[model samples]
Target: MIHQSFLDLDYCARVSGCETCRTFRRAFILEQITGRDVEFLTNPDLQSPVYAVLRIESSGDRLLLTSTPTQKPSFAATVALNHEPRHLANDPTKSGARLTTDFQELRRVVRDCHDNHECSSRYRWSRRNPTWLLEIMDNNQVRLVRGPKSLVDYVVLSYSWGDPAEMPAAEWARIKGAGTKTRNGIPVPERLNPFSAWDLPETMRDAIDITKELGFGYLWVDNVCIPKGTNWDTEASLMHEVYGNAAFTLVASSSSKATDRMIKERLAWSHRSKAVKLRGKWLHNTQMPLDKIRLESPVARRSWTLQEERLSPRVLYWTEQRWYWSCPESQVAELEELGHVRPENKSMERRSPQLFLELCRTGDIEQLHEEWLDIVEAYTPRDLVEPRDRFLAIAGLAVRFYSAKSEAGGSFISEEYLAGLWRDNFARHLAWSVAKGANSRHNLQHIAPSWSWASLPLRMETKTKHAFKPSEHFRFISVVEEKEDSEKAMTGPNFTSHDSLSRGRTMEERGRGVKVVDVEGRFRRFVSDNAKQVSWDAIEWRRGKRVGFDFGAFPGHDLFARHEADGRIIAKDAHSGEIVGQLDYVVPDEALKSPFTPYVPCGGEKEIMCLELGESAMLLLVRNPSWGHQESYRRVGVAISYENRKGFFYGCETRTVRLA
Candidate 1:
């Protein structure tokens, strides 16, 4: 590309003719800033490639800029100008951030987020301090800050733990020792007499150095402060507070592991254009897109970091591409203009910090669970290092959720946490199953109740998006008897219901938008039996009427209808060759639908039971419980009937069964 001055660039474009002006014109018009379109808006026609934006300056620089080309024009396209060039740093290595305009505007955006955004202030500063904080001293020696409040503001580091086996023996020993020493408690401001930035991991070293440069006295790098093998019981539970209260979080996104550097490398981006020298000054372009900021980096894929980013008041990230600041309102990329983004393009999950407060204020339980399902959709798919961490990894986020739901002097919902799910929404919450194309596995340790998603290294799907249908399928089963759960818990025994069962007595009831009672591990999924096979002991049929087919639900997980309605496997009764129920697989594999004989390893054909969730949705519970939990049952799959079967679920086996 030829270098052209800012003013002359438009002239050359007009003289040479325009290529994307039509698209740019339509996009610019959407901004509603200018009434008419112009022949030459700027020297380079930077049509939006991802989301659209047209820059119009607010300062003395009455200049206009453009974005790369996009698929089609958008309603959100806006006319805006890039901020001062000071925000884009000439040297990333020296600045330790992306889009480092020497951090001139960076500080302002940070201040605006901290001082102005209430969502940021309310949840943040709630935790007085983390168990320990590393104080950067004038001599460059890092001192530990623990107990009580010595510092009001500090930065927290969110990075990857990486593969410990790859680390050196000596360094690994130090990391393990750090956890043990801290657990027993350490002296105040214990100066690690020999500790220096050089003695730390590359990511930690950069974080500490950058914290110093940012003029903060303390930085909380987990590897050094908390370390590997530390009993999370002490620090893990305080995650929401630790990250939330911090002045800001410094994310080492580019660094894959502790050994990787956080200074970042930009040599790969040199080939592309970013700036052109005009009158001995660089007229820079806003190149970073909104989607590129949070969704792409490797750190975003880690389970703990997802909660870290969601809980933090403000996050300052150093990805391989650029540095950006994310808060409740919007994300500010260093090189781009302030908030050069289309609000619609921002990820809702990323807005969790602010959304958390708003959800709590509304005091609505259903909406909160929906938000949780959204979190599960995103969080469960990401990788987990320790299978048991399914709950702990999200413990911080769960705390916020529990606190939000339980805000008004506690509720039946908040106090009851069975595995990773809330008791009140257990029915609707049970609509998750392994998403298609996801190679998920059940944990050998059963770290979670078999009824919870936490039991597996989750990659799940739910019926809300797919929308389960109950009317079209259920054949109507009768509950032979009704009795209090006689199986006494070591103490009090109670009833937990599907989020949809409040008005389930009527045939017209679609199981949504109803009052809920706290329940957990009451039911699970149903499995289909190809033959006229029926677990006679599992089902108590009403006099002349046969119980309908519940051939789809299986144990250990849940799934959706719309998500995978492509097709289903036909489940038939083994004895009569009767078409009973159908099993919906997450993926529409031809083989699955071809012969819907979903076998229960080493066991013969069997039928399952269903618990009504909403009008159309019923959780399928295989009558068989695992590992001799005879009085209890495990979940399998969820069943949705398109046709109304309000009467179908009536006359069902009403017994006090436990979910083990």
Candidate 2:
């Protein structure tokens, strides 16, 4: 008879010998389960804890004890004790035995993702195979194979490398030496077996084991498969194809770094099968559910993983608590019964390019804009080793979105990509504001133009209620690359401006040629044409203080108010006092006459531009608080006039002026 005692601290203490031995054994067990070393355990400041339940499985003839620190100690004990095994008489017809418990759920999830037509049909697999795959042999030896033509399946690993400072010099040397044979122009395959399996990062070892268990002949890990240096740029660009074409992507979600293990500490009894006689047949029961896992894991928070998660047709996300399966057709946990769906699954279903085409058909451009903003907000906060990879990281999604637009008849979408912003809806899309309490980093290598949100390395928010009206009169003369000799256009690497008439000139030259004018001529003309008399009763202003106005006081005032930093405005709905929308004051071409006209305030350098909302007209004020301030400006306020204010600007004279 076999007996198991969970959370058996006394038994562990007895088996471990003295106090010193017990502590050492506990640390070693924790290190084995969590892939954390003694240093990580000693670091009190680390967020993840080291405590876990210890399970001891024993029989009359033999004693077996197993405990992995990945499982929470408290819950492990409760689950183990709650599902105690029931002894039954053995019968020849019914054998109480099954296959290995390791990765049972994983195998099922992978099989379902592959076999299900609804899920597998969505993945667009490429005919061309990767140049190399890290092959793990039966002996647990790992080697790089050059073009395995017979291999039709491979798994990709998505994980983080821990802080560089903590990485040992020996490990760094091993990583650098991984492909040294190929580095000297040799075509021979490089073998990684010289390095001990223990030396490999925890994540790498786990990924290798997972790949083998999943019946895959090959695995692709970025750090090992791709050589570092100049070749990295070209390889990095192919990320979309690499991840998108994989059989499935394995996400080490819970582990922030390679050393952190994905599996959680749990009792051995919890995994042990509980046999029961149901009617005439014996039944085996175990607890395995998707509910224990979390969607927002540390791995999900990474900037690079965003594309990997979206592009891959299938993903097996291993978190600290549970395992989750996410494919285009379904996203659920191991124990979640079929038919039970999560909202995230619905969101994932809508991720395809087909959904974007539907939006285009309905002319739901605002919803599309909102979706893009959501992506931007999620991507911006994640960490990126190279800040320049900002646009590149999300470029895959942009490509898909662009393709969707093409499929929906490109007339509705903008062909020009101004850095990260689209040209067709340029004005309204420019209404992005920096997240409050977030500061923009100055030395970002300036990969984008100042006007684009990508130029600022800060989280951004977009306005909801307020819209930037499209102006047919306004023309995008041209956008030039800031770098003189470089061939890469200012428009993202994946995009090119279709307009040949728009010349690629220097920024200074661009500024010198463009101009803006106010068609209303003067404030008196704007007032006379719009209304019988100027409504001074509702208008109020302070001489020197920060500008303030009541939206309620000015009845016909079209300009909506919002906080400049986060673009959040107090909602008009009296029931819910919620703030919404992101607003940024845009300064139009200097060639255009000021929309403020004769009402231009004194003391500061004031610039005015037409604030176009969807079928609405308003005015925006950008003021340099002090004289001689070249770059700094504050968005003072906004004002709206009654009726279609476009009539006032009809036959407006055009002027050539520069815009900053």
What are the lDDT figures for the candidates, one per model?
0.50, 0.46
Worst 10 residues of 2 by lDDT: 517-526
Off by over 4 Å in 1: 1-101, 125-127, 147-151, 164-191, 227-231, 268-292, 337-353, 409-415, 437-445, 458-599, 602-605, 625-629, 640-656
Model 2 RMSD vs true structure: 12.8
Model 1: per-residue Cα lDDT over 1-660, one tens digit each: 122222343333345433233223323322221111121233245322333333344542322423333433322332223333433344342433233235565667777776677755455536477776777877667766563565478899987766566778776655444431433344423344436666666777778877777767888877567644466654665687788788888887666666667664342232222233343433433344544445655576678887787777677877654567866666777645445222665454434344554565567676677777767776765676676566667766676666665454343342344456655556566666543322222342246544555554454433334453322222222111123422222123222322211111110111111111223222322334333333422232345665443434332222111212422222332232222233322232333332222222213224455555555565555444343533444454444543533344444453344444
Clashes per candidate, residues 3 or more apart or on different chains: 68, 29
Cα deviation of 195 in candidate 1 (Å)? 1.4
**Which candidate tops TM-score?**
1
Angstrom error at residue 363, model 2: 13
TM-score of each: 0.63, 0.58
